[model samples]
Target chain A: MRAFVRALPWIGPALVLIALVVLFPIGVMIGNSTRDISQSGVDRGGVGLANYAEVFAFPYFWPIVGRTLVWVVVVVVLTVVISLALAQLLDKAFPGRRLVRMAVVVPWAASVVMTTLVVHYGLEPYFGIINAFLVDTGIISRPEGFGWTRNPGTAFAWAIVVAVFVSLPFTTYTILAGLQTVPGETLEAARIDGAGPLRAYFGVVLPQLRSALAVAVLINVINVFNSLPILRVMTGSIPGYDADTVMTMIFKYMQNQHRIDLASALSVVAFGLVVAIVGVYLRVVRPLEEA
Target chain B: MRHTRRASGIIAITLATTTGLTACGFGGGTDEGDGGEGTTLDLLVPSYSDATQANWEGVIAGFEEANPEITVNLEVESWDNLESVIATKIQGGQAPDIYNGGPFAGFAADELLYPVEDVTSDATYADFQESFLSNAEVDGVAYGLPFIASARALFVNDALLAQAGAEVPTTWDGLLESAKKVSALGGGIAGYGMPLGSEEAQAEAAVWLWGGGGSFGDADAITIDTPENLAGAEFIQKMVTEGATQADAGSTDRSPLMDIFIQGQIGMQVGLPPTVGQIEENNPELEYSIHPIPTQDGSPFTLGVADHLMAFENDGDKQEAITAFFDYFYTSDVYVPWVQAEGFLPTTKSGAEVLGDEESLAPFLAVLPDAQFYPSTNPSWSTADSAFKALFGQLATGKTAADVLTEIQSQVDAG
Candidate 1:
């Protein structure tokens, strides 16, 4: 108690910073979610949870929620699986491995919006490189009148692919760091105990990556769930919310609908969903960590 | 003790930060004041062309030379972001002293703007065309000053029409038949450039719905699901199903489709004045003619669009400076050049008399008398306009015209 008292000044600023930056905004968002905000953003008096009710009553709400789930699950799963394989391969110390690893960071290092825009333009029907190549190779003919992102389904699929592409570097690096910590002696011991290479890896190395995998999965789940740029740039202009995720829907509610109150309500609902999903994940992972 | 000195040091740092922050707050407040030092006005306007900022800056230079006590800070934003930028600025309590954009009803409804009479010289207020001035009124009180105007007319690709053995369409049925004939030419060519996409679907909606003898309702009510409006929407769906428009008309935007039309691939489209400049710059060889947009009964229909400049009631003290700025801006010497440079129809009578003789702008001006506008005076028009932009494209997809119109009607009703 005495030491904590003495340390208060040192930590006080950090606590104040957190309160101002994080807690204050959350409080304000919750308050605004209950208020009636005009299109010009004038705040009318509180309306309880009417904004939330409006959000739930929105025609596209359920579909957007479903798509958001699919987005988070598919992107995170692909990212984790691909990163695992890439990490395993990199651990073998191949030539040009340093250069390849640096190259892996390009999509992650570049601005997500910029990268998505390049991909978006590259898929344009008129002069896009991809469409040109496809036509040249006789894969698609010009008479078909098709663009790569013409359909919402195809556009959402491409957005997921881009999401996985950008998510690879961080997940791979985390898993690679975990792989390095697994001592070589343990793998040799497992091999000497009559296990095959695959068996040795699954038995010896996989269990040691548990904590790192947890961190990667948790972070990727949150990041992919909250991602806006890939979905926005890839399929934002498509008429309906058929390809929309919750993050993009929140943006559309404010931008297209001019319903700031609705956006805030959706934001709070999204916040709660993230917390619940992360809680479940932690509960499932904590026992394994202890073991 | 060392602990006592450390605690004292921390307290001193906190005191210094609080004082510094408070000082900044006071500094910002004073800067916004119209003191003897000078009155600084923040003018936020949308970019009409690449030269938009330079033109405004030139006006400011002259205005400042004439009135040395007023300083105008200019911020130019793209038309796509202008609405949200103004909204954000208003929400942040930093609304500009003057703003140039469309849809002033929401601001006027909130009493965030000074009425036109308060912010403009009496002469300048009287200078606006009667029709245009009345269009800016909300509940019989004007809030917006007409800044620029453009009217839509049918742009026919003469070469394409001739190749397809079609003439310039004068009625709805004639339009469909002509578009079909052009589409039959094949080779990745769209018959009619129909852009019902997110960018500016409302403009296309106005052209068709109004042409079909439907209205988007008056200020008191909004009626989107009328039979005439349905006919208009069904025409778009027909265009899509018959392969008269480009692929994915649901997602295609206006600017790019306009580019295709400029490339001489489209037979006909409704276009604005700036499209003339675009064709000149990109494809001067593409022969085209401007005609009245086809109506169901062969009556003249042109979708008139105008952007307005409005003054905010910020501190209720910058009125004099804003008035001076408006008077200076609306002067013929200052206004005519800006209008000519941007290639838009002038909204004032004097400015019109000067530019009505320009060859390229004459056709649009000829159609201006029959012009109709979106119900921008209604506070709910912004909501309806957005609904049109976001949902109108669904007609090209699988959504029925009736359903889409009903959905838009419900949105407007909810508002």
Candidate 2:
């Protein structure tokens, strides 16, 4: 007790914050998941993980889990790849670079809900500008334009597009910061050795952005996994389980007259998946400490 | 510099300690609110647009004038946001004394309701529409007062009907025939507008199901696949097969369906009275007619949804304050104009009697007393509704109606 008390001045605030902010809500969630929650969201009492059993037993549960996994992977991979390209392009000296970078950042600055609404309208089949433009350009017929939101495949595709749109800037900026740290002298040395621009970027600079890329990809994975706005708004809350990710399902479970206990169980599982991914990432990254 | 840093550290520790204790208390149990000289009632109302909020303020001011000793704190939550907000508040044990909501069964089951007799006058309780009261009842105990009601009816486009040379359809066969004629117009017109999507699958399906003498699950169960309900689902499929409704009706929504109707792209659709205002606002030249949803035997039946005012019990003084305010607001002079200003139907039989000759609402008002509501009584109905919504579009696919219905049943059972 004396030794712990002596250390309190240095570590007390963090321990107190974690106890109140993190552990309390987590405790509440696990406690509620063991109980029956009324539609009004009051926990009636413990039922010993019956909520978890029920949620897992749903016919679509595993499929939804698989879909969520696929969504996070696809969205995060696409975001990182595109953002890396943009970051490399922006890092090069060019006229009108600031304007292009600002344009890239606009989607990231937009309100996610508003971006979802704009994307929804832009993708509307009959009266949308995208369809009109595509039709006028003779790229697609009117019938092709009218059903993107209705079809699961196209709807999921568009959801990824919007997700990537809003996620681009932060990833780009993160990579650009990493690129800045890649010494100009190193690029100069590569060029002195007859290395072309692409070769220098690939062989010399790209390897140095490993940590930034890893951090960016990890955050994108977690964020895309929890994203609900794109799917919710574009589908108008109708995208069936075939197209829905786990986050949207959790939202559906949390609506009026909701199954909050089950939502809690699902949430705990989602958190566990995120933690597992991070754990795997850290294990892979553990080798980087010596570098 | 070391002394200044130490002082800053001390201040930071003090702030963190204070915040930690407060947060811990909030995370656990907040002390009961007690600040007023007399009683304070916090009322959580569904968010209102400007006109409706003004009317509510006027009524609240009048009540406050009549009872100065009691204070009412009106917290208006957005309709889309109220669900999560109330759930958080209720679960946190800080539920408002009165809240605006429908589907009160969960609250009633949780034993959270303050009960109507506790917060309503004897006269108002006796005079309310019994269906409104009974629908708000759980196990023979009334827990809510019906505040607004809506009923669905068929809306027809006059230009399309005239072009197709068809009259307003009152029978299912007649409706299908009209839809076929409209589709046969062949200019990219939806024969009929169908909203078999998630946002309102139950609302969309209810008109057909109820008209066919089917019902959603009663007090104890969910009835998704009864023969009558299945027949209704089959009829919807038939409408799609015959090109009497949009081929992509499963992907459509109420707004788009209504928009196409107003634009004369669809011949007929199911709608409430406000559809008139919406259409009139969008296209003044469009002519339309309203009637009851068609039935196999040409019977008069319609689907309705309602919202209610509920009081959560905390103390006798708060309950008494709520009762006093409710009695003041229930008068014909106050409520009738409110019903008129907002286009919602009357909630009380006496309010309907007062509006007997109001021609504008006659079509909807005629069916108000007998209108059936969504089966919100099942504490699990909300969960089931989402599953049903997700499965509704499967009717347009290879899945059988029984499969879709059973999918919903299985989810509800599992949930």
Candidate 3:
């Protein structure tokens, strides 16, 4: 009883914050999803799993779910790999390393919307520099420019590209910081044991960077999954086209279609997916720590 | 370490609570100030353009001169996300005194809008055109005051037509023939361009179906799968299959299609009266003429829609002010200048007279009599719109029109 009373003051604030911030919104979202929300207001009816049923019944929903998964996986893997490579390249004592490091962080500093618009307009068929070069270099027989947004494959690829581009700077910087903390003596010991640069990197450097890599990967996954503006601005939330992201779909349903209940339901589903992904990640990484 | 942990826990709880409360308070505030019985009237219209906003201000000045006691607070919202913004405001109990919006009556009938009966009277209703008045009526209750009207029309580039030696198509057959002739020019130019992207696309596509004597939903049941609607779908499919339109039409929205039209890459395109203004701005020397959307014979009528000025039922003072402002807005001096500057057909009979005198707007006004409003009187018109869009998107992507229509009909019926 004395120990409990002693901890009450600190525990009260933590409980209040959790209840208000995380639990309360989740509760509201769950409640909203079960009702028929429209332009008028929420219709407080017992729509037991009906919104979820509709989401499942819709043919486009699964494809979007599949696409989102692919989007997250591709984006996370590409971001981590590219960022790690950049971090390694910058880690070497090279000329203009400071300038290169600054350049690396520029993409992270640029607004996602600004970068998307630049990419969108810059890839225009008639006037875009990309197409202009392709045509000028006789890369193709026709002037039919690459429809980065219109084609589904290319759209997915570009979405991944944008995700990686936005995520690269921060992840790279973090990995670089992680590399700096790794003792030089470990690499020296690997080199003395006749390990090549590649072998030493794989056995020593990567293992040392595991914690940073895990954090980077986890953050990248969440950030990419939550990203709305790039896809929303580029695709305008048209279903079955470029709008495959869960956030964009939610925005479309709630704002464009006025189907708040369905949006909320989808949001809950998204939240569950995120939680499950994190759980699986933690479970998988547990063994790595003990090793 | 224990002290640090305790402090962090407190901070986290406070942060969480604040965030939760903030999210919950998004759309729950009530409007405190009434318009106060005196004379200041608030008019909320979606922002269209800088020039139009200026014109609205000028009209308010003119209105004030005529009725010195009345003042208009012209609040303009952008079209993008305007519906949600309005919905949020209205739901939050802070609805504007007088707001103009497209498709408000249907929303009102669905219980999304507040009733405006106290502000409107039978005498005031009698002054509007029958079609205009009918567009704002739901379940025999007139919920909105019609302000401005627009209809879809075909904007034809005469130079492209001349180059192809094609005449203006008045029928679906004629349109198809002309489309082929223009596409044969072989310079990346298309015969026609219509939005096939989403709901707006569906609406534009439905013009042909409706013109061909097709009806989507009846009084008690949905009928999207009728023969006429299928024929209309097939007509669009034929255009796509025959190489008249670009294969990308299924994915392109109005803006890019408009861009294509402006770049002289499309021979004919369907656009509102504003396209004339856009053409004038983009290429002053462009040879383009406005004509009625090509029909499937039998005196084809263009699809017309209107934006309505409505009042909420919460505050009496605001309602009275809104009523006064609506009355002022329809009057000749203010409404005429607004119609002329904004390039939309006026709603009132007298207001139409003013629009007839403007050379650029005359063509749109001329087709007003031949315009057909959306026929559904159901409050769930937005749902119908979604079903229609889904159906039309499938059709545009080469799905069997009959199957898509059947699916849409079933969904609408179920809804």
Can you tell me the CAPRI class of model 2? Answer: acceptable
True contacts kept of 3: 0.15
Off by over 4 Å in 2: A1-15, A137-145, A284-287, B1-34, B48-50, B376-380
The TM-score between candidate 1 and the true structure equals: 0.94
Per-residue lDDT of model 1, residues A93-139, tens digit only: 88999998899889889999988888888888776777777878888
Residue range with the least summed lDDT across 10 consecutive positions in model 2 chain A: A282-291
- Candidate 3's C-alpha runs over 4 A off are A1-21, A125-129, A140-146, A237-243, A287-291, B1-44, B52-75, B110-117, B121-123, B218-222, B315-317, B388-391, B410-415
Predict model 1's lDDT versus the native: 0.84
- 2 versus 3: better lDDT goes to: 2
**Per-candidate interface DockQ score:** 0.32, 0.32, 0.31
Evaluated with TM-score, which candidate comes out highest? 1
What is candidate 2's lDDT per residue for B1-415, written digit by digit as tens? 7545643443343333222211221223545556767677787888545576777787788878889987777777777777777877887878888888866777888788888887888898887888877887777788878888889888888888899888798888999999999888865677788888766777877877777778888767877878878887888888888889875677777767688788878899998767777777788888778888898789888887888888887544576778888898888888888777777788887888888787767888887656888777666666666666767767765577788777777767766
List of clashing residue pairs for candidate 2: none
* Clashes found in each candidate (C-alpha, N, C closer than 3 A): 0, 0, 2
TM match of model 2 to true structure: 0.90
lDDT of 2: 0.76
Better of 2 and 3 by TM-score: 2
Over A1-291, each residue of candidate 3 has an lDDT whose tens digit, in order, gives 999899989798977866765877777778877877655554557788999998777667877888788888888888888888999999999889999999998988899999988877766554567666777798844454554555455655666677788889999998999999999999999999999999999999998898788667766666777677777655652324335667767776666556767877888787766656655776777413534
